[model samples]
Target: MVRRWKRVMAFLIAIIFCINCVMNIGVKGTYAENSNKDSNTEEVHTSAEEKEDTTEIEKETTSKAEKNKSDGDLSVDKNEKTTNKTEDDESKTKAVNNTILDWDTYKSKTTLVTVDDTNKRIYVKTGEALTLLSNCSAENYKDYIISLDSSVTGGAIEIPFTYDGYEFKGLGTKECPFEGNFNIANIKIQSTLFAGLL
Candidate 1:
């Protein structure tokens, strides 16, 4: 019975090899026929209209390049003015309780909402608004703590900014609920629980 099984396996292998050889020959013939046809085909000639179109495209591209160059010069002037304004703002800023405060403008008597990078905290002064940096989302600072400073009992923190289409309603905490909508609730507490489970 073992000898019979070995003979059958050898026969199947031989048949598969013969089938592959036949398929290869047929594919080679098809490719050779296609190449011969391609060689005998006529060359394409562009019309006068096509040549004019190509020139127009080139002209449009050159004009766009010139416009971009002019825009770059305007951007350089804008950058200079921006740098001067930033230097002025820095000179006017004052540090209080290890947090940088931008006293340029504040709502009512409230202070500016500033980020404490060292302690990974964001301080939101009551009645003042907090607009996060560009390309930043609420989930980006999930680990950072929020410190609210309110002189009045009913004073609320307003977040009226959006980042990359994500609205900044607020990240509500149990102690200090948000005045408007919120995307997350007590992210720190949730993260702590998840870590404990792990």
Candidate 2:
């Protein structure tokens, strides 16, 4: 029975190998055929009239959206400044707390939001990493610890102004929630949470 089982397993392996070889050959042939066609093909061109029509349609859509904003169909700040943006505008121009915004402006700050597994550039306040680093810290010291790793040079405690609303991972205590929507550039809590702001 053992010999029969071995023979069957070997037969299955051989069958799988043959199938894989045939599939590889077929795929290679298909790829070669497509490449040959692409090399010989000429670029398609849109007529001048067609281009003009497309432009006009796009312009019309844009104008309609503008008209809606003017008519108050879209949310617009009544106190919005014409030029020379205020400091508040610069920092608060993003999703706040739990409020969501679809604008690319928020996503543009690649460091703030968790995007594509590129780890957040979170840092501790110079000397806070001594107690906790990897996992969450004590409930009481949750607000104190942000990160243990000190990637910054010169012991610079000031987080950048561009890092508005940046949330720190493995921060906050059991008593206090993790710091979210925090302006690391302008840290207020000094000794209580951050040691210095690295």
Clashes of each: 0, 5
Listed in order, each prediction's TM-score against the native is 0.28, 0.22
Clashing pairs for model 1 are none
lDDT of 2 by residue, 1-198 (tens): 999999999999999999999999999999988877665552223455567889999999999988987877333454454233665654554434223223244334333322221343334443222112212232333333234233444434533322334233333444455543333443332234432232
Question: What tens-digit string does per-residue lDDT give for candidate 1 at 54-131?
Answer: 889999999999899889988988998999987765554422212322333222223445555567655555322444
Question: Local distance difference test, per candidate?
Answer: 0.48, 0.45
- The residue-level lDDT of candidate 2 at 104 comes to 42
Q: Pick the candidate with the highest lDDT.
A: 1
Model 1: CA > 4 A from native: 1-46, 94-151, 154-198
Q: What count of clashes does model 2 give?
A: 5
